[model samples]
Target: MTADDRIAITDLINLHGHLTDRGDFDGLAALFTPGVVYDVSALGGGELTGLEALRAAALALGEANPVAHHVTNIVLRETADGVVHALSKGLGIMADGSAGSVTYEDTLERTPAGWRITHRVVRPRRTPLRG
Candidate 1:
């Protein structure tokens, strides 16, 4: 990917946190494709497809949603199939001051609008077992 592509993708990932923390579900959903697949099964949310499903899921959280979201360590790679894969770390701070972290695996493609996530898998960050 070109430098501009990387910056755009990075900005897109960062925008997610801002939109979500602001409870702008509509803006958040705009970051993904219409037929996006969001797999949060590791967090017991199962898989959600489509922009409507994503918006519904976020709205369903209500006050349970995190107070803030921070994303870092974004690594993007392009595959032979012309899709970009992005892996990043996400830190979510809850309203109760509790925080949790997860790994966000995302697949994105260049759409007519812009680079949008087509699929994403949110996995809990596990601590390594003691030796």
Candidate 2:
């Protein structure tokens, strides 16, 4: 891939993180393929597919907790045609009245439309509030 290709992918993913954290479903869905396999299992993320399904999931999550997701350490490698393996670290600030941060690992790719997330597995980086 050319340098431009790499740059494009990086920018696309960063935008996605912004959309997700800001609860911009329309923007988020625009970055995916017709069918997106978006996973946010890191901090209550799961298999959320398609625009409609994912939108609902995002809405629910947004309502439950106000969030701020900052993405970093993005590494992108070409896997195959229209497919790439992207690994990035996401810092999620979840506000359940009170806010706390959690780190997540994400795997995503580029599609015909733009960049679309395939898998996002989150592991907590710090101890959360105990009930």
Candidate 3:
């Protein structure tokens, strides 16, 4: 991938946070492939397949969704498999002033429209115990 491709992929990952924070389900769904696989089992959300399923889950959240989503530490890697692997950290600020962090493991591919996430696994970050 070229430098522009890397930039585009980074932008795509960042855009997800913006769309989700705004509750723009339609726009959020467009960020993924039609047959995207979104796994949030770590958060008890179960695995959601396809764009329609993703949209449904987002809409179901309603006002219960986080007020803001901040993504950082986005590391992109291109493998021999022809897919870009993106590992990022996401911090969600809730309406009640509580915040939680998770690691987003994503795989993106180049599509006709642009680079899109084909698969994502949302893993909750555990607090490290002090010895």
Query: Cα deviation in Å at residue 7, candidate 1?
Result: 0.3
Score each candidate by Cα lDDT.
0.92, 0.65, 0.89
What is the lDDT, from 0 to 100, of the residue 65 in candidate 3?
81
Off by over 4 Å in 1: 126-129
Tens-place lDDT per residue, model 2, 1-131, is: 66877787788777876777666777866566647665665556676667778778766655565467677887877765756676777665556545444443445565666566665555656664799
Query: lDDT per residue, candidate 3, 70-99, as tens digits?
Result: 999999999997799999999998899998
User: Each candidate's TM vs. the true structure?
Assistant: 0.94, 0.71, 0.92
Name the regions of candidate 2 deviating beyond 4 angstroms: 41-45, 80-82, 96-110, 123-131
Model 1 agreement with the true structure over 1-131: per-residue lDDT tens digits: 89999999999999999988887877865689888999999999999999889878988988989999999999999999889999999999999999899999999999889899999999997686689
What TM-score would candidate 1 get against the native? 0.94
Candidate that beats the other on TM-score, 2 or 3, i.e. the better one: 3
Inter-residue clash pairs, candidate 3: none
Ranking the candidates on TM-score from highest down gives: 1, 3, 2
